[model samples]
Target: MKNYTTPILILFLFLVIAIIGNITISAIGLFFNHDVFNTGVYANGYEASLNIKLIFMAKAFALLMFIYSVYILIRNLKFLVRRDFFNNKLVQCFSKSGKLFFFSGIVGFLASICGILNIAIIKDFGSQAYLNIDSKSLYIMLMILGFFLLLFSKVLDKGNEIQQENDLTI
Candidate 1:
């Protein structure tokens, strides 16, 4: 079987890009929707209006991000299910990464559910009754989660290295 390093690298890059994009969109959305930004903040409310648009845009982007995450999860799962996966370092790495990606997917799904619930609640109630989330706290949490994931990925890389060495010794 071919070495899994290339696929791992590609998947890693894809994940990093998705994480960065999601964070940016989420931060922008939170910034605009926050109460801190009054309606008349800039140029007769241009900033506020822009931020409002960004909020909806971020929601859409977030949904797309979740979809992309599922794609990554599936790709990694497929890699892990190969018959020689147990003996293959690359495959092992993929499995480790896949598990982490699976957890990430669960989180993404939860966030998506929350967003949907919020939308439904807003429809049933009104903006006056709706509560907005703080962008800074959300961003910090996401960044922390991303760092943990990165650490997990590093562990997977180490697994790959150990597997390769084991294979050579056999």
Candidate 2:
């Protein structure tokens, strides 16, 4: 089973790279081709100079964090293939991956908030800014998944101790 782990890890790494590439390309296209700057008006019914660049920067930062988390996960998977599942290094890798996942979720949530606030601040005082909760759910899911991963690392640590004891008895 361990012999197959390497190939699977490689496949997943390639998949993550592909996904990142696609997202980068699409983001570049959207940022350059769309007229996002002139789309919104100020609270006083005047054309406001909305800093569209900040929106792009926030999105890019979130995407980079997500990519970084995926990279950490892939690195951990590679370590799992090369070392014992119960090894200290493997535990560290798992812990790091979990933290990265949680961090990515926070960064994504903040990005959404920044984007929404940017629009709201410039919009008419009485008019409501569109609040989309779709990304919020995804962010929450990421946080939960990260928590589970941390819990799993604890379980693996216990398993490692049991395996060590069994080895000594054998």
Candidate 3:
């Protein structure tokens, strides 16, 4: 397990760097692309007023949360590498990651709702707001995964206590 840790850490670091780079490039593009805010058909097959800064802000917030979750995962992996798998710090990191994931999902769901609302407001009965199934499902999945991660953290904490007792007995 120790021998595998270094390679896994390296892979995770590469993924973190890649995701950060993608986010940075996207931010730069959004900054330069004035048309991003213009009224247009979104990728979700809905027509909406895309010019609102709130839309961008929501997306940015969600992305940041995702990054934070990944960072927490990295911290958890660091504990594993250090052979501190059952430590409180590791459990805390897992808990934090779960919260971030849940929050990000909510942000994404709200952002989609905002887009639909924008369309309905601008069109004024001419257009109807439709539910975005993909976004809704993704958000639901993320929240579920986050909830399980948090539950796992509690199990880890219990395991840690048991391990400590066994160590002392030995």
Deviation from native of the Cα of residue 168 in model 2, angstroms:
5.1
Candidate 2 residues lying further than 4 Å off, grouped into runs, are: 1-51, 78-83, 124-134, 165-170
lDDT of 1 by residue, 63-93 (tens): 3444454455455554555654433444444
Instruction: Give the winner by lDDT: 2 or 3.
Output: 3
* 34: Cα error in model 1, Å: 23
Candidate 3 lDDT tens digits, 1-170: 66876776788778667656654544433443322433333434543234444565575577577767876786567688777879999899888888888888888778767766766776432122122222567767778878988998989999999999999999
Per-residue alpha-carbon lDDT of model 2 for 5-120, expressed as tens digits? 67767876786676566555544434444323333433235421334444445555655666676666666665666666887767766777777677767776776776667667
Q: Best-fitting candidate, measured by TM-score?
A: 3
Candidate order by lDDT, highest to lowest? 3, 2, 1
Candidate 1 Cα errors over 4 Å, as ranges: 1-48, 83-145
**What C-alpha lDDT does candidate 2 achieve relative to the native structure?**
0.60
Residue clash pairs of candidate 1:
none
Better of 1 and 3 by TM-score: 3
- Cα-based lDDT for every prediction: 0.47, 0.60, 0.66
Show pairs that collide, candidate 2: none
Best of the candidates, lDDT: 3
Q: After superposition, how far is residue 132 of candidate 1 from its true place, in Å?
A: 8.2
How does model 3 fare in lDDT?
Answer: 0.66
Clashing pairs in 3: 37-51
